[model samples]
Target: MSAPEIYEDGCPICKERLENGSDVVQIRQKGADGINAASVQRGDNVDVAAGCKAWLNEKFAPDLLETKQDVVDNMMLHLQNMDENLHKGHVGEPKSTIHQLELERLRFVLTSYLRSRLRKIEAYFPHLLDQQRNQTAEDPLRLSPDEYIFAEEYANNMSLYFRRVALRHMPTAQQKLDLSKTVAPPDLDAFVFLQVKDRQERVLIEEATDDQEEYVIDLEENSKHLMRYKPIAPLVSNGAVQLI
Candidate 1:
């Protein structure tokens, strides 16, 4: 069965209780079979919305984006609260079933989002690690703390495996993993479908063919386009456009 519809009304489960002076927003869930609306806290709804957007961005971006640690953490907290509440309700109840379905859906989105980043890290660990090493204190971190550890361990293990399986047998001069020559970085020139969130002026589009001259175009707000990722990379990171 489909999950219940969540609206921005107030949450039914957590009432309007503020924690640590945090604003308490409410959400209304419309049951699948036209049952009455149920309330839920506003925090859960906001975090879930952010989590879904982050998921889509991670899925579409060629390079790994900054980790949305706060969004993930908040969503996880909400999921835990929902799970505890569900456990208190009887099985076979329509409300419980709806809650269960919605919980599963959120889990899937969060799982898929994390898995996408892990796959990218696995594919470009060496390059990603190098980037991490070179980043200054002011730069935003590309990997979360856990992910950074995973990438480091994965890089070390791969290096060891290569040495044991083949590198040791090579000539001493050749027994090295040259990351610059061995690792393939993500292709920023790849084309992506995106929707513009804000109007952008004089966005440059480099010519693919040598014979063609480069040109610039304006990206109107709310318009969709297929374009190469490189020139618009900053726009995506700054939330001006959403990759489809």
Candidate 2:
């Protein structure tokens, strides 16, 4: 996970202060009350909204401006062994044994780094592609503003993974051997089955609820629900629920 994998509640004031799209909220100071510096992103005092915001910046901000071309260029420079010419070593004048060994080691590092990023991209790309279709739905992916900013980066990563790596140097005749691996399904937003473990009143805006009344919902201990992620994120992070 690119974001902090971390979530609970107490007090009537805290319950009342719950923001839209959150189960709870609490005000926290940067550095106050004789407190030492700490990670502001994930903490006992931080709530869902704050967590999501920090998650976005950590996961996606750095690549917000990167494009598909940029990713491809990077892959070309660093994502080695994809090119057909990797086996055709020592094209130029022969170098000393030490120099050749160093070059080989450098190639290994570059290839490993590229592979690591690609794996991360693979894990995260499905979520991102699901967001970008822009189709209207009852339960959409919850993304912070900063996460929206990183949409392009997600697109670029997908392009590199699917178009570049999957299709690279492959002849058209035999390409059909395995095309399914390149496919990204749009079923990311389907209801997730979770085992809820806490008894807390939760609220969210939905068409099912007809009146302007805050419903007191107690997730029965050791019970399961097929629900969307918006209301379930905090629960999962706080160990109140587990995705099944």
Candidate 3:
């Protein structure tokens, strides 16, 4: 896909910020056709491009990925700052329209990214909550703080509803809500399309049937492939590959 039209040099606010060195936003030239943008900070950089990729990955992945809290927070701050700047009349006419369009596009991405996560939470609350409860220090967080709260409440509400609606009338042994038997986990074996950002050697591809031999394949940088999500789940998490 061609790069999104959100980045434009015509905006006066961006131009002024660039001249004054007050705000730093840069479009990265390498990888994925220069679709990634970076928001440079003092100690760390918040990548808007990475955020966009994460949004796509979350949208396509069956399971919830880690929250890009920094990207979301930075982009929200950018939107607020631009809105305030526009109100102060720093940008005029066509340039203001450009700024407004950029803001709207960003807002759509941020909203949709969060919405996708919420949908996943609603669908697999039981499994997700269990995973959260059992997570170890080495494990990356699966849910943000707000999402964790939402999952807990959702699971409790569902359990309460089940009891009130049907379980109350059933035998005591049959009244318990066994989430493992009731809730379906995300299908790790589901096929997904992805582009390799970094070349990986001997990546194993498991066979769908016992009759077929499992094999390993090299994922060359920038190469695209259609494969099961399970083996490359770690790759997706680490940014070695991006889900398309």
Task: Write the number of the candidate with greater TM-score, choosing between 1 and 2.
Answer: 1
lDDT of 1: 0.76
TM-score of 1: 0.80
Could you give candidate 3's per-residue lDDT for residues 1-244 as a string of tens digits?
8554433443233343344443333333332122222234222344557668879999999999987787788767766765786677545565566556666777888899999999999998888888889999899888988899999898889889999999999999888788657989999999999999999998988755678877889999999999999999999999999999
Q: Between which residue pairs do clashes occur in model 3?
A: none
- The collision pairs in model 2 are none
- Each candidate: RMSD to true structure? 6.7, 19.2, 5.2
Cα-based lDDT at residue 165, candidate 2: 68
Instruction: State the displacement of the C-alpha of residue 151, model 1, in Å, after optimal TM-score superposition.
Output: 0.6
Tens digits of per-residue lDDT, candidate 2, 124-236, equal: 55554455456466533344344445545766665667656665668876445322255443343446676665654553414344665644356777887776655555555
Once model 2 is optimally superposed onto the true structure by TM-score, how far is the C-alpha of residue 153 displaced, in angstroms?
2.6
Q: Ten consecutive residues with minimal summed lDDT in candidate 1? A: 30-39
> Per-prediction TM-score, please?
0.80, 0.28, 0.82
Q: Report every candidate's CA lDDT.
A: 0.76, 0.41, 0.76
Instruction: Give candidate 3 misplaced runs (Cα > 4 Å).
Output: 1-13, 16-45, 90-92, 207-212
Could you give candidate 1's per-residue lDDT for residues 65-106 as a string of tens digits? 888888788768867877998899888765566568777877
Query: What's the true lDDT of residue 46 in model 2?
Result: 21
